[model samples]
Target: MTFGQQLLFFFSAVGAFNGLLLGIYLLFIKKLKYLPDFFLGLLLLMLSTRVGISVCMYFYPDLPRIIPHLGLSALFFTGPALYYYIRSSFQQNQFDVRNCRKVFGILTLILGAVGLLYLFFPVTWENYFGTFIYTAWSVFVFITVYQYYIFSKQKIVSHNKFVLPVLLSNVIIFLTYQLISTGWIQVYCAGGSLVFSFVLYANFLILFNKKYHQVAVKETNNRYSNKKISEEQADNFVSRLERLMETEELYKNANLKLSDLASRMNMSAHQLSQLLNDNLGKSFSIYINEYRINEACEKIENGSYLKIEEIGYEVGFNSKSTFFSTFKKIKNTTPLLYKQSQILTEPRFQSSNL
Candidate 1:
């Protein structure tokens, strides 16, 4: 490679390498258990892998066949990671964790099958499978943008300051790849990698700004600003809270986060937490999980056709393990055994229903 090309590769490759390290830090080293952070780490890792491949092929045309395959494989997950990160960062019912995991599982099987084919028929993978990957990536990018459009239209986008730039950057990268794929631009793999480098660093600055840190600190300081509520106020708040739970069935939403609930109730999250802890003597999770477990018990006793996991999803628990453990904690037995006991004691419910 000429010096110019080598320099281009160095700058671009540096970005990809730095992004990889940052991604690893967020995924494994970060102490916070934030779901958005996890998804963002996965996104950065996938994008870095894809860009690294471009950097290699741009500099080394005679690279091993496996490099291209791995690059394209990473592209498959890149779009999904972006989609899931956006979904996880928000508290909308449309972006349930259960659905996110379901889509991820489907994508895994797809890429797994494609990977096996690539191992045996390299030419087919290059000609057809590569196109499929680009197509899938394009579709995912479109879906993510469309989903964001819906959120924007409904005025439900709380974290747009962070999400918009990511969406825009991915769209540009997608457009660049499409241009190259369509032969509009030739031998611009390095250009795409360069764009990834820019996007990755820009995201780093945007996400890790000092302003966000101040926000976190301010929230912590304000958590106990005025924790005490009068008896009448507490009674009214509880009544409204219960009414909302019963009528709106907010607990049915798998993405009904504590912050979102506090916003709906016209209070800060800390205030809500104070009320929950001081007055109700329960943490937010236990309170919400109690409702979900009760609903699961009702569904199990009703002899619903849905599987146990499905029941968990229906009651707003994101996973079967959470539902089962919460059920055991509250009901003192497993769901299946509880169902059997109910059936034995009330045989009419079993016979008359079906």
Candidate 2:
């Protein structure tokens, strides 16, 4: 083989080894045990197996033909596994067997289709069919990337800086492999493996970092669970939480999250959520909005002379419609009507005082 081919082979081998190590660490060494971590491990395993086989097939062309078919089958899992990994990482839902089954079922269908095509068709026809399958996989990657983009904008999940870039790298690598027909497939494959290995290692370092572990440990301990707390304890906790909010005016932060508030109260997000739901009979949104709406009411009554929308922004409502709806819902009157009532009452108060 030429020097270029030798270089590709070396990179591919290194990538495969790195992937294997990362898969093991994700599956075993990572203590968080989140569903995303499991899916990520599966993704790495599939990637390593697929890349390793590709390299082996190139180096030793006489290998059994079935091996390549198996590698292609593994390719079908990459897109879906990555999609789920990102979704499960950002989402708060616990692992659901039904979701896992759905992903597995899609993968099974793809593999079965590819297997049947290989069995019945000529080699050239099988290659063509495999191309179509990979094209579909590329589409899957596109959709998953789009979903991640939308989710990031919603701010409902913690953003991982590496997830999007890693996913886009897959899309780019696959497109490069498909589009460049001048025997550059090996180059793209080798480069892709290198990139994937780098991302996996970086993610491993981030996940198992000392700071992250310490924070996770503290958060796990504080997380609100079924742990029994006395009624008095619950009340005291609520009082402290309320004082923190009132004194700090945390509700004024438009982007404030339950977790953020919980941290300020020196508790877990789940605990704060439970306290609001069980003790206060409100969700976090309602609790925060109550403070905001009350502040808006005072501004309106005092004739702050600001536009209603401006007042909404001042009180931490991100949008005008939300401010109007929340105010109406809680106060049972529009902001304008409330202001009018206050204006009418002020004259009566002055006359009575006179």
Candidate 3:
């Protein structure tokens, strides 16, 4: 191999190695064990393995035959891992055993089928399988991108601006590799190793920034030590908040944000956040959504002619899925079920009157 080829190989190896380590650290060492973190870690590990093996097979063709198959298996999981990571990032529920079983079962079936095919089929057939895998992966990526777009439109609080850049990196890597595979580009050995490196490092930087902000907040809190307020002040804040919501019906705005509410109340965002957390012991989302859910219940009980989905939207939910999920979470039952129970009670009351 020429010096240029050797240099690319070295850089690719370094990226893959660092990615593998980062994935392990995220999975094992990260204190906050969020489900999304696990999925992201798995994605990073799979990507590193796939890239490392591909680089190895290119530089040392005499390596064992099993190496390529292992890499292909890792490649097969990349899209699914990424999709789940994005999905779980926005979810509020804790990851449980049931979720683990479902994800693992599906992954097992896919890998098992691929393994069987490789065991029985001619070596050349694997190329056809690669085409199908990549095509499916592209479709999944598009679906994920569309999901995020919808989230953005709805102004979901969990939608992180950083997620877009990470997703874009994935899309770019996939497209560049696809172009190279199809002989549309002359780049040597699947481009975008540096891009993958950038993404991994970017994640680290985000994490660092978050930690730094937390520490800074802690220091400020220690110095001020006077965030507490009297009961009268708390009541005043609560009354003002309620009056604003009652008068303006701001809760009906599907895209309402904490900062928007804070601005309307003539308070700094941090002050508003602290008031909610310290006084009410509720996050802004929970407090706002409680009002929304209460309004939904009133609509249901009043026998409004609107459909359940319409009622959800009218009460400020941005999407039917989110509305149902949050309603179930807060109300301890689904909207349709709650409405049906209310209807049943109404008939009993009418019969009693008769």
Candidate 4:
């Protein structure tokens, strides 16, 4: 094989290997909901990009144009799935069929349209459609980057750094291909640059995955370091804590403190703090406040009919102003507004299912 062919082969191999390893890692994490769908989408993207390049070189003119169409279509899932995965990470629930089906449904439509178009088209038309598809692909990626920025603003740590480089690399790759098609660049430079772009982008993906996984593992270890429990044991402990907090009234005590809770749970304060911070992804104060705020909101909106000050005091707030500020920060609105909305919605809810 020539040097260019070898380079293509290397990138194809790297892309495949990265996809395989990443899929395995995501599957095994077991904590990330909807990870399987995200991994499957990404694997399709990797295979599509690699195989598209191969078809362009070795099989072009002889290849059915629909292959490239299928490949480019995979880009939609790869970018959007990454954003979806990030959003899902913020919630504790497992990923469900309803959400995954939404993505697959859109992909099905795109693929169906492309196939119908290809069947009625000629070679020149297919080439034009390919360029159009590439343009659409680029736009899709740009939108994903923007959406990811919004999610990162909500404080996802991994996305906080990785989106920019990957976004830029993808744009550059698309532009290089466009230039080549327009005959502004030599064929070799165009293809070589595109391959190089994927390689760099793949490296960014690997680094991002590494940083995220390392942080997750470190946080998990910190939570279990004192008793040195296995990861499964630590997960069980944290799961039990979550369940107890939800079902038992013990955590609702106004006098509850980190040390007190730790002693009751037969664990050290440091360990408890780690579990709250790492596993639950919040500081101890924040975690406690979340529960307190929810309880206060309940009293305010529900028939508890307590005064704001009384609700605050009941939920462990030292002062009404403190409760007001904390509640506003968490719920992004004033207590009175929340109460008014709840009041207006109550009759509708009572009369019919919400």
Tens-digit lDDT track for model 4 on 1-354?
Answer: 689777765664555455545555655544543343454445335534644444464524567645655555654455455545444433213235487678768877976776677678756466766666656566666675676677568643331233455455555655665576578876753263345447566766788897797667557756766664557867988887777677654434544578656655666677788777666678877888898889878787776867877777777776788889988999999888888888898899898974
- Candidate 1 residues lying further than 4 Å off, grouped into runs, are 1-10, 23-42, 59-70, 80-132, 143-167, 183-188, 210-227, 230-269, 278-286, 300-302, 306-354
What is the TM-score ranking, best to worst?
3, 1, 2, 4
Give the TM-score (vs. native) of candidate 4.
0.50
TM-score of each: 0.63, 0.54, 0.64, 0.50
Candidate maximizing TM-score: 3
Off by over 4 Å in 2: 1-8, 28-32, 94-96, 159-162, 172-176, 179-189, 198-354
Pairs with backbone N, CA or C atoms under 3 Å apart (clashes), candidate 3: none
TM-score for candidate 3, please give it.
0.64
Report lDDT (Cα) of residue 101, candidate 1: 88
What residue runs in model 3 are displaced by over 4 Å at the alpha carbon? 1-6, 29-32, 94-104, 159-161, 206-352
Clashing pairs in 1: none
Candidate 1 vs candidate 3: which has greater lDDT?
A: 1
- Cα lDDT for residue 161, candidate 4: 36
With candidate 1 superimposed using the best TM-score fit, by how many Å does residue 342's alpha carbon deviate from the native?
Answer: 6.2
Which structure is stronger by lDDT: 1 or 4?
1
Q: What are the per-residue Cα lDDT tens digits for candidate 2 across 1-354?
A: 899888878876887888878777887888843567787787777777777787787787899988876776777777778888777766533335597788689768867876786678856566675676577568778888888888778854442445665666566656654554335445554555555555556656765684686588666866646675567878998899889777757777676788778776767777778778887889999999999999998898888979988899888887889999999999999988988899899999999999
C-alpha lDDT of all candidate models, in order: 0.80, 0.74, 0.77, 0.61
Model 1 residue 171 CA deviation in Å: 2.2
